[model samples]
Target: GSRQGKDERTTSPSSNFLLSHLQSIIGSPSFPYSSNSPNSLSPLLFLLHSFLRICSIPTGRPIRMGNACGRGKRPAASRDTSARDNEPRVAVNENESDRERDEKPAVTPSPKASMKRSSTPPTGAMVTSRTRASTARRPSTNRSPNASRARDREKEREREKAKEREREKEEEEDDPIQKFITYALNKGVSGLRAEFEELRLKTIPTKEQCSVFHMVANAQKNRYKDVPCSDDSRVILKELSMGTDYIHGNFCGTPKNPKRFICTQGPLPTTIVDFWSMVWQEGSEFIVMLCNFNEMGKVKCAQYFPPTQKETFVAGNAVITCESVAKQKWPGEVTIRRFTLDRIDVNQKRTITHLHWESWPDRGVPPIDATIQKLLQMVCRSSKPAVVHCSAGIGRTGTTVSIQIVTELMDSGKSMETGLGPFLIKMRKQRAGSVQNDQQYVFIHRLLLERYMSEEEKENAKFVKFAKDYDSFMV
Candidate 1:
């Protein structure tokens, strides 16, 4: 009996120590290592008492740690409770068992992305904040590649358009040099009649040159007397184009702000008055007689710069008037022909060569332009020299000059591959510091190319139809 008692004492004290340690962890009164309350016993003392009671129960009597209340249940938490009476239930062991059961087999857990997050109070705030911030600013995930590319292309197009406008501005400043180069290329060049590489066309004018007529001179000699302009109307040059376009200002610092249009108002717009006056001053030999010849005249421009001055036509830029009769030693004869577009009569009457600007055609304009083109072909067929003219004899004049150059390219058997660009460049050079607006230059080329291609289309259509018929017969 003494041995059993001794063993009981030793076991009881050890169990009390463990229970007291657990209750201390929860700050329960039953195991309070620290206590400021008067109603509570030290945790070690209560735990020791409970161990003694449990020991007694092994002898067959049951041990109850607390006094039996009206109902055998723990009291609710309150400030009045003594530490010993408020002992925690022994459910810690059951909670541990449940956690172990629910947990997955311990995996070598993936190293947490933010290695610093695993801690006692795992706030994980830095990592979470970083994740949230990145998610908040993520690029929109909704756009398709096509939409993105289209936006990029649109931006690129705008950039290109800006660059083109800048380049055109620079070009206006560089006009003189461009014009000089064009002149160098086109000087001593007549419409395709002379071989450039084979012969020096600069040699004195010949019978072949004689074969062609100078229609510009003819128009000058036969120009009607007068068509007075209204005193209120004025003219100005809005811009100078190199080949097809211009910057927004004039070469002379006068801002001739040109509006884009089809130029169907008259033979030429009044914006180029200064330019025309300058041309007139340069050549008195080319007399432009604006007159009222619209009714009987076959040419549209004839109404303004009529052909009454046909007798004044000469070989050069001088009137060669008998000033005091001493300067009349070298005499030049003038020949005049009526300008008309009657197919049979005009063709026969047109002995010399000519390309008439007044005879050319375009939409909303008289067929004079067409007649000009026809006269040009006839001149080429018969191989005659001709000249083209208009009222101011500059814009339409320049256009006719350009057309003749294209025909010359054709007649010389030279491919247009080497001609059109150089041709316009030359025409601009021929006219002092003149520029074709982008539309005008493009229109001229389009018209010529369209006509040229129409012939090709006719030929191609015939061949295609024949091939289809042959296939059908074979089937």
Candidate 2:
């Protein structure tokens, strides 16, 4: 019983504490407390009555029981009169009351107010109702008609544009040209070969078909004119940084990787300076010379680099020196000549790996050559773009570049069928007349097919002896 009594005393609000708290609320000048105020004191008196009832004390009498009220016990007076006399009250003037009420901000109910409000009975007052209503009716700014309409229109436009895009995408999915391209790209080497054979026997690029303006205008001698290097994004001499004024070579690379090749024509004797300048400017590490110095008794390409005996040649501001020449082992299918090109003006030197595929006749395919594949591998491994060129830099050059791209794509896990056609199209866009004839196109397809073959499939006993003879022809 003693422990229970001590617990009650510890948990209950001390009389002094309650008295001081009530004094603060009633004493504040800004508080809307008034003795004459009917509803205000009703709530206050009701709360005190509830507390006294909880203490198991009589509630009808005003009693001073805490040390905080200046005396320890209730004064000997009647309950109602003492309650009114001792309670702190502030006087109010009608004018002062109006000003204070207007200026005094409404008090927001604390989180504890809800629990406490229900714990006590209603005091016949509207204090709690007004607080809840003020919170519920929090002010918000109004929007103008134009602003609201603009927002609605913006949302409507977004929805409409989204629907329009969906329709366009559906139309594209149904497009015949897009379907054909998609079909062609997804083909394996075998399918590509069959397609090429069909095209070779059936199709040709007529003059009327070649309508692009720059393509028609930049042709050389009108004979090799269709294979003009793209002038718009043509490779510039980095040393000079002069745009499109130097060489007839355009920067052609895969869409995923753009700095892959400088597709250009075989350097003419007169254009040798520009060619070397391009190599140095592009930081080209490999010079893929696809044609010979002469083909079918005609000088198809200039002897751009000096031979073994004559080790040096000067071209424009650069001096070309043969560093080392290694001919592909007997039946030399490809001759690899390493040259150190010295920029005389800048006193800088860079070594260029020159790959020469000699026996590929003009507009004709050589006997299945492994040397080209070897060259492609070397180019793929190199960090810089290979400067690739043939007699016109379109036929043989196109085939070789296409092979390199297809092989690279295949090695990267892309299906061979989808990459070659798009690669050839992109190549021709950069340098016109690429893969010029049906034969060259077929050669590209055949090259990719050979990669897909088994060793047994490649080993033909019928041509076993011809292979030996072919080596002699290559040498």
Q: Give Cα-based local distance difference scores for all models.
A: 0.32, 0.60
Clashes of 2: 4
Let me know the TM-score candidate 1 reaches against the reference structure: 0.24
Regions of model 2 farther than 4 Å from truth: 1-223, 238-246, 330-332, 415-419, 455-475
Which stretches of model 1 miss by more than 4 angstroms? 1-370, 378-385, 433-435, 454-475
Candidate 1 RMSD to the correct structure: 23.8
Tens digits of per-residue lDDT for model 2 on 1-475?
A: 2111111111134554665476565545566653333435645554574464356432233333221222223223223344354333232222343446446444444445653555432444345675666655654335667778999999999999999999999866764433433443345334555665554344334444344324433333222554544545466565442223456676777634677888887777667777887787778899888777877788888777887734898888888888777778423378888888899899998888888878778887765657677777787677788889888877888787777766656556554334355566556666666677655665565444455544674475422333343344334
lDDT of 1 by residue, 1-475 (tens): 2111111112244455554454444355443332434534445554555455455322231113221111223423223223333332221111244345335342223334333343322243344565556556656656768889999999999999999999988764454433332332342122211332222222222333222112232222212322111111112223332221111111110011111111111232222322222223222122212112242454434222223424332212222111111111111111223332112322321112111222222221222124436543443342212223344333444454455555445544443434345545433323321222322333344335434443544355433443343334323
Q: Where is model 2 poorest over a 10-residue stretch in terms of lDDT?
A: 2-11
